[model samples]
Target: MPRLADIDEISSLVLFVASDDAGYSTGVEFVADGGNLLGPVPAAKS
Candidate 1:
């Protein structure tokens, strides 16, 4: 589960990037993960 802040941050970032304010922006990957990167993972079965 992702936190509200993560979603909001991504949403705002996207809007800003799409607007003229981010005209000078280049290739960038916005990762909105709320510290979940260090959490556990599920097993993938074949």
Candidate 2:
């Protein structure tokens, strides 16, 4: 149900998205978990 990304991952993505390195980047959605949205499962075992 990963609603949030770890600091490192977010930092990396943010850097790239904001950098000239990602000049062509667009419509980036780091949807932490759409699977849970579709399934909507809580208390399911990992």
Candidate 3:
């Protein structure tokens, strides 16, 4: 499982999103949930 992301990690995204470098970034859909959309993993049977 992926570990929790640091504040800096998220802050970096915010910074970039706010910067002019991302001026062309329209309708951006950022997903920083460590791949939560992949759904839960199944448990292994012993």
The candidate that wins on lDDT is 3
**C-alpha lDDT (0 to 100) for residue 32 of candidate 2:** 44
Report the error of model 2 at residue 6, Å. Answer: 1.0
- Per-residue CA lDDT of model 1 for 1-46, tens digit only, reads 5455756778898899889987777787656676687696667898
Q: How many residue pairs clash in each candidate at the backbone level?
A: 0, 0, 0
Compared with the true structure, what per-residue lDDT tens digits does model 3 show for residues 1-46? 4579889989999999999999898798988887778988789999
TM-score per model over all chains: 0.45, 0.47, 0.70
lDDT of each: 0.74, 0.69, 0.87
TM value for model 3: 0.70
Q: Which run of 10 residues does model 3 get worst, by summed lDDT?
A: 1-10
Which candidate, 1 or 3, would have the higher TM-score against the true structure? 3
Question: What are the per-residue Cα lDDT tens digits for candidate 2 across 1-46?
Answer: 5576578876887787788987766776655443666775668588
Model 1 clashes, total count: 0
**What residue pairs are clashing in model 1?**
none
